[model samples]
Target chain A: MSLLGGGIFKGMAVTLRNFVGSYFYKDRLTTNDYSWRPSDKLPQHAGEYPKEEGEQLRDTTTVTNYSRNFPMLLHDGSEPMDTIRCVACQICERECPPQCIYIEKSTEKKENAGGKPQFYPAKFDIDVSVCMSCQICVEVCPFDAIVMNSQFELSTPDRFGGLLLRRDDLLKSNDYYHNIHPEEAAARDKRIAEEKAAKEAKKKAAAEAARKKAEEKAKADAEASEGTPDIQEDAE
Target chain B: MSLELIRDILVATVPLLLIFPTLFAFTTWLERKALARIQNRIGPNKVGVPLTRYGGRFSLFGLGQPMADGIKMLFKENIVPRDADRLFHLLAPILALIPAMLVLCFLPIDFPWINNIQDSVKAFMLDGAVIFFFAITGLNTLAVFMAGWASRNKYSLLGGMRAIAQMVSYEIPLVLSAVIVVMMVGSLNAAEIANAQAGWNWFIFTPWGLAAFIIFFIAALAETNRSPFDLPEAESEIIAGYFTEYSGFKFALFFLGEYIAMFAISGLAVTLFLGGGAGPGVAALPWLSVIWFLVKIFALIAVMIWLRGTLPRLRVDQLMGFAWKFLLPLSILNIFIAGSALHLLAGGRLAGLDEKQPILRQLMEGANPLVVAGLWIGALLILYVAANGLNQLSRAKVRPREYKYAE
Candidate 1:
């Protein structure tokens, strides 16, 4: 009798929940995508798009299209491609375990030809197929050349043709990068500004030292011409 | 074919087919939600958006999670372990799923989706559905074995062995319990059994009917490999049991099969005990019968989920002991009682034997009150002792101590 009571009550509790849930969450109760409801209001950032002036955004907010980090959310919330953080560093390419990454560094005809922006990556490619998403490249990148993008919906029928990403696809502006990762971007910007200020100060000190040396040389030449430096030379 | 009948069959079957997959999906969601609730967390909330523009911004919590999962599996690199039985590994998940899907064929959803199919020789009409349902469910064990053997892994092999033993052992009680049901109704057809339980005479409400329902429910739980009977797939022990080596769409197929089997068992339980699709005062309104059937299935499914959340997995030896020593004997006794009661009912031996009989008829009835009371009291005492013993035994078996590798 106890066994019967426990089992019956336990079973009844479960059924009661389902019976109640069926009414409140009816859309979820069925297998079909009945949760879809179209709306007329455009996306919040619709005004930002210059090309779509006065045009309404299509409401595709179906249950099927919802995702936590949806691609649409990424587009609307952040500009992820703004920062030119890559400094033609080959570290990301070297550390990529899959060898999916390729980089062509900019080269000059002459070595040590006055600091004229010595290096730039001329070509870059990341074969997403072979890339295992291990984040090794991102972790090892010294100049932060690569980072994992949250846009995961990269489905395409022609796998071979559509998956490989070129430099153009990878390239993003500093503003976009700041928008997506604001905290990291702010910290990086402060660090870079400090380094630039230090470099300018060092350059100013060197120029001042050079000017002092030239002035001493001119004074010595004038003293020789005038025979006035002979007393100090004899004393030394 | 008469157009009305054809339409009826189509409508009936389409919902049934749709319900199967829908329940499968919902079960996945329900499991996640329940597990999350137990762990004090939210699960799968990022799947979809709110239907209305002004409604509190909604997301299905990754409700399209299963879709994404399916797509990922489809596109994933399918790797077969080098040491595995390649042919069997490739064939196992499909083998497991096909029989599960096939079981849905005999299920009657509502009235004939097409009433005309009754006359069509080529229509999907299962004459002896009870036997067919049992035969197919039995075949599911073979698929489990194939999965274990194909993997070439020790954990999987052990899991397979446990599953086969557990299922084979429980099959007796399960069949015997249903045998009593069939004996009482004098029919092996599921629909007939359901029809027999019409009105308030639902089998669960009767003395023998209640016993059979309890026995059937326990046996069904064991048969489905659900917890405390879920030793076969005990995660801590077997690492996903027989499917350790499977991945991608193959893994999904195994998952789909398990849920579908769960669905079938729930449907079976409802049909056998809780009056299948029969509703109170619902015979007059035929359309409401389908709704009643769905309600029962969902209720049963919810119970399975709750059990999963509440119970711990039973150890292999303990599980076998419980099945053989307790459930088996109880089920056999239940059958005997049912058989005797049914025989008496058929022969009208118990008719007019009650205290309500007239004075002149009472002497002719010749009912023995002491014997009846003794039998009832004896049965009650046995049940009480068994319940207390089980409780004490479970409590005495303290949880295993956790081993730490380092400080």
Candidate 2:
């Protein structure tokens, strides 16, 4: 009889604990809709969210200033978000399994008088409905223009039109991108600036050398036209 | 003819009937979620949208998934093996499924009779419900054999043999445990047994009652071919076992039957050990009894899911050894103890005890605490030793022998 009582009590205790505990944690764990809220802070990368107070301080102040080559932590500070290393290459569009990504190359316009076209992506769109979230687009993107976001709560009505995000919807400012993926963005910006500076320096050195060579040639021509062939006779 | 009475019956049954299927659907979701958690991953979060009528935006993927799975099974091309017995092949799934659903008819989810029922006819009868439940469950083995033999496949044959072996081994313990309850209550009716256990006197609170409950639970697990004992359809050893040759909706019928069987057996456990629909002051408010009953059933199902997630499947011979050697003997002992207690109570040797006092009260009054604790500890130790011994013995028997070269 005692055996039976103990067993029943033990079982009851387990369930009672669970029920009571759930009630106590209701405020933190409840999935009710009224609790959800949006914020202005940039979403943290996949695994790089701050943990300790010290880590949070480092993440907010120091980590955000690091260059693009540095790994960006995502959601739990466990997954690395390697962004900004994109070369603007269109390989991701071609390899997308769901064909959700659309990219339009910037083309120079002959009709309009203009400087050399730097970048032109007129209409970039991604249909989130069609996207399988396989991360294939992220994998194949040469310029790393597209990335997998940890923002999973994308519920909407009307499957066809509501889920299709245009360029405006997907676009983030450079500062916002850096804040989310600090280390990677900083590294990329530094690399781009270094490459541009190196190209300019090379061009300037070549032009200076050419100018000196032309001046020397002009002096020789003028001296030849002057008819100064008696230099050796005067020395004798 | 009264509208209120009709509404009451409809309200009662609609919930009872819906409870099974709704739990079945949720069980599918829960199983996936639990398995994913065990394996360190997320599962089915993308299905049906959250906080919406149609479900959240991403929820369509999750919601449509089950529908898509069903349609795929429905449209799949059915293939019949050339050498298979066609008649039995067609009949087996139906046979398996029908009994699974039929047993629910005897299951009393609410009051025995609604207020509007003519006094001549009882809306529900709990009398002989135990025997009826056992009889239907007994037929499951036959369906399993039919499926195995009809397929004409070696794996199917092996699976069928295992099922028969398991069912035979567990059936003795299952029935013996129930006999303990019957002897105490002096009635075969589930509702009567429940009524006998009013207030805090649920059968699970006594010496024999505890033993019987454990024995019954373990036996039921084996009977349902659930995890640890689910050697028949061991995916690693025999892919899908008896139903390997079955395809399309025919195969789905078997799947559905298994889950329904699981629900039925869990319901039976609730009826036997947990006092069925008898809760505090529940006789007056019978409706609350059903709710209490369902809460217990769902809790049991959750435990089943947890067990499935946590444990690996047991080997075939290990399963048989556990049932025949351990559960059978323990359950038999439990019956004897219950019989002795009943005899003592009936003879009036124990004072201040009503013969009709629930099992819980009898245990609280009559049993020696020290002896009870010793017996329980001893039983647990014995079970542990027996399991390890059998595991070793099986290993030794199956060990590969090295061949000696002739001199």
Each prediction's TM-score versus the true structure: 0.57, 0.59
lDDT of 2 by residue, B161-242 (tens): 8999999889889999988888777677766676766676777876677778888887888888887678778778898788
Count of clashes in candidate 1: 25
In candidate 2, which residue ranges exceed 4 Å CA deviation?
Answer: A1-236, B1-19, B29-84, B112-128, B152-154, B339-407
Q: What interface root-mean-square deviation (Å) does model 2 yield?
A: 8.5
Q: What is the C-alpha RMSD of each candidate to the true structure, in Å?
A: 11.1, 11.9
Which 10 consecutive residues of model 1 chain B have the lowest summed lDDT? B355-364
lDDT at residue B363 of model 2 (Cα atoms): 50
Question: Model 1: per-residue lDDT, tens digit, B29-67?
Answer: 777776554434455655553345532235656566566
Model 2 chain B is weakest, by summed lDDT over 10 consecutive residues, at B115-124
Candidate 1 A-chain TM? Answer: 0.54
